[model samples]
Target: MTANPARRSETSRQAILTAAFDLVGEVGYAKLSIEGIAARAGVGKQTIYRWWPSKGAVLFDAFLALMGGGPGDDAALPDTGDLAADLKTVLSATVDELNDPRFDEPMRALNTEIVHDAELAAAYAERLDLPMRELKRKRLRAAKEAGQLAADLDLDLAIDLLWGPLLNRWMQRGGPLTHEYVNALVDTALNGMRQGAPG
Candidate 1:
């Protein structure tokens, strides 16, 4: 039997999402709008509105989908049991992803949206940042449990250690994302900012 027409409609919906994602990545979110998305997707404005409430919603979902975080789905962070190792594995991959020329444009666009639109910022937090942050927390707690981390170590501090340098690296273009760089991050995080680990 042939596929249902609803499935075909869903396919077109996905096509619209793809077009929005690509166009926003190319032109930037400021220039991206529902009308522009329609033109790019070859769909009608009403058709876009039939499914989404705003351009921010579409672009937010589009970026998530591109990141393998489709509707009702969350991206996996990593759970390899070895805390430093697992964090290293996931963060190393993230470093490489962030450093990619392909990702920079969309990320900059999304960053702008985060600042400009309160609703979009909330949507982005709900869909993307919070889950990733929770995953990082879970891993750090696990590391504490495994005795790989100091029992007195603060998870919040651990999280800062994990993300802070990466943020600096991206904004400052401080350095490239490399195995050596990631290893150094892990070491610096575990060792402390100004002093060596307790002897």
Candidate 2:
């Protein structure tokens, strides 16, 4: 009996993504190659090239999915009115995903490649980072609109204030991306960055 074409394609796609994750993790990102993922997934070189142009693209897609923000889901973000609480929850989830063994290799692949490959960096920024920035920015702006804080605020700066520190801490490995550390980050961000207290 013949299998369904869509099902077969999905199976192949999933296999390729999984193989990319393992290869990027086992070998450093620079060492990862299309030949490697194709071989690991038991697919032809053309199969990978046909779907994804570069290892960075594959890695970005794989890790973003692992982070619960994949397959065009990057536009999704939680906004619970309380900016502090919302950011804390979202960033904490991000921390958990980053620290997961399943996610470690692919994320590292994406992050490192962005440093050296301008094209890949641009794609990654467009596909992943911009969404993250938008999500956080929207939440902060909403907080301001709700009169949760003062007016005439710089929303981008506000996002940077709350979001960048956690990212900085993680990228620098300043400390464990622990819940305590993340909560501290959220607290520091809200207290230090908020424009003014509510009346």
Candidate 3:
């Protein structure tokens, strides 16, 4: 019987992504390399280059795979009708994820790569950032309809306002990422929007 090339390719791809994900965590991104990843995955370096343009790209895909995010995955935020509560819930979970030690090194590494690599940044924005933002917008849009937020709120700017501080704090290591902090951020952002909203 002939081996199935498609199945074999999928297996190799999975192995490579897993290896990249694990290696970045174990060794940190500064020390990660294509040769190291290939050896860890038990595949040729060519296989990785065949699929990804660089180590940063590989790491980005690996991060996405680990997070279960992709083109077709559900990225919805909680929309329980209470906009502030829902935002707090979602942002609190984000705080937990950002503070998780297992994800700390890898996330920092990915962020660093994104900052320096234009291609990887573009991929991250398209595949992860935009989708997540749209999902958030969907939740906020619902809240707007329910009179919880401004009807004319700029959803994109609102998303950024709610999330930007948290992200900046985490990336800058300015303070602890806690649920309380997330709640404050949610409250503050929502309050500002509501005040500007036409009653």
Q: Count clashes in each candidate, considering only residues at least 3 apart in sequence or on different chains.
A: 0, 0, 0
- Listed in order, each prediction's TM-score against the native is 0.83, 0.84, 0.92
Distance from true position, residue 195, model 1, in Å? 14
Q: Give the alpha carbon lDDT tens digit for every residue of 49-111 in model 2.
A: 898888888887777666565336446467766777777788788789879876766676677
TM-score of 1: 0.83
Best by lDDT, which number? 3
Question: Number of the top candidate by TM-score?
Answer: 3
**Could you tell me how far off, in angstroms, the CA of residue 128 lies in candidate 1 after the best superposition?**
1.8
lDDT of 1 by residue, 102-199 (tens): 67767767776678889889888887777777777777777677777777777878888878898778767787768788877887787762223575
Candidate 2: list runs displaced more than 4 Å.
Answer: 1-6, 67-76, 195-199
Runs of candidate 1 exceeding 4 Å displacement: 1-5, 70-76, 193-196
Candidate 3 worst ten-residue window by lDDT = 67-76
Q: For model 3, how does the per-residue alpha-carbon lDDT over 4-42 read when each residue is reduced to its tens digit? A: 999999999999999988898899888999999999999
Candidate number that wins on TM-score, 2 or 3 = 3
> Is 1 or 2 the stronger prediction by lDDT?
2
Query: Which is the better candidate, 2 or 3, if ranked by lDDT?
Result: 3
